[model samples]
Target: MTHDTGLVITGLAKRYGDAAVFQAVDLNVAPGEFVAIVGESGVGKSSLLNCMAALDTWSEGRITHDGVDLGQLTEAQAAHWRREHLGFVFQAFHVLPHLDVAQNVALPLLLLNRPDPARVAQMLDAVGLQGLGERLPSQLSGGQLQRVAIARALVHKPRLILADEPTGNLDPRTAAQVMDVLVAQARQHGSSMVLVTHSEAAAARADRVLHLTAQGLQEPPQQAVSAPNP
Candidate 1:
């Protein structure tokens, strides 16, 4: 099947042995759109995001981004694809402990062999970490570390962003700040974003909020209202 410039998952499913993690999952994230997935703990929201990133396997159906079929790529090919076109943010703020904040943010550009110090600086400023690039992750607060992760993920301007509970580790006020940065950067880059979170406040910022169940994704009963654009 043909797809335009966006993410498309069709009839996707994941399993281990006889247990099904989720099945019949279908989703489409348009370019520059922000989508949030929410579910109870152990319901595979993170698994679904991993599958979208091609970092994990799915049992059935297809996942495509900008017309490229992820399932058809080999492991090496998948790595290359991710390096070139994907940005990921994690709740754990997976910055390298040894690398200073700037170096950590620049890793993605370095991997693509297109390092741009200006771009790195721009990202740091955009995320409100303007002057802390020289500090180690250990020296920063939880919120600051998460901002570092956001800057790093967005440094290369990936077409798709997959964030798994990025604000889960922060206090409510910090989480809101992080979301503001994340949403602004995603908008600035015009990247499609798929965020999985348990926080209703985080999900409320999405263009569409869907609930993930073992059967598939569906609208929540109340249907989360998207926050107005700032």
Candidate 2:
């Protein structure tokens, strides 16, 4: 299988007035690759992914998807680009309580002005939510609710998938299961994924791991997980 060779970031940097987040960072993600990003609090992991996803603007550097520059797009163009090529899974489920399971998942398709009931149901079932079509967001557990979010993201079959703290709110077992679901499905769709997570176990699920720091995303020369000191 051929992958698009993931996003490339060069001279990537960001700042918030007097505070600096990332600088001179470079990254690459091939299609079907799952990348995990981790760092200390306030280290700008989410900020970095946000910029790459075109949700936040950066001070310099360029982010490209299939060779299309993201920083150069107009607002309308950016919106259209995202609708066509990107899918996002947030830590918080972000489900609309007023809408049932199917509606929430169908939102992207709905916004695109195309709705296919069979396709939507297939996505829901893919996430193990077959008959919950009528269930409200409040009726599900943390994991189940997140599955809804996953279904929603994948329903569009976007080229890039950005997940921020996706499992931060779940217990360890639930988080693991959810991560498996995400990883497996993303691979099946051949989507490049950038996951921002603090859990080492979650990071382990990725093919590569990077730390967001003052110097941008840094690939640690030594990669391993160690048990806590006695």
List TM-score per model, in order: 0.95, 0.93
Q: Write the per-residue lDDT of candidate 2 for residues 145-221, one digit (tens) a residue.
A: 99999999989888899999999999988988898889988998999999998888888778888887777677754
Native-vs-model 1 lDDT?
0.92
Question: Lowest-lDDT window of 10 residues in candidate 1?
Answer: 221-230
Per-residue C-alpha lDDT of model 1 across residues 19-90, encoded as one tens digit per residue: 999999999899999999998899999888999999999999999999999999999989998999999999
Candidate 1 residues lying further than 4 Å off, grouped into runs, are: 1-4, 223-230
Candidate with maximal TM-score = 1
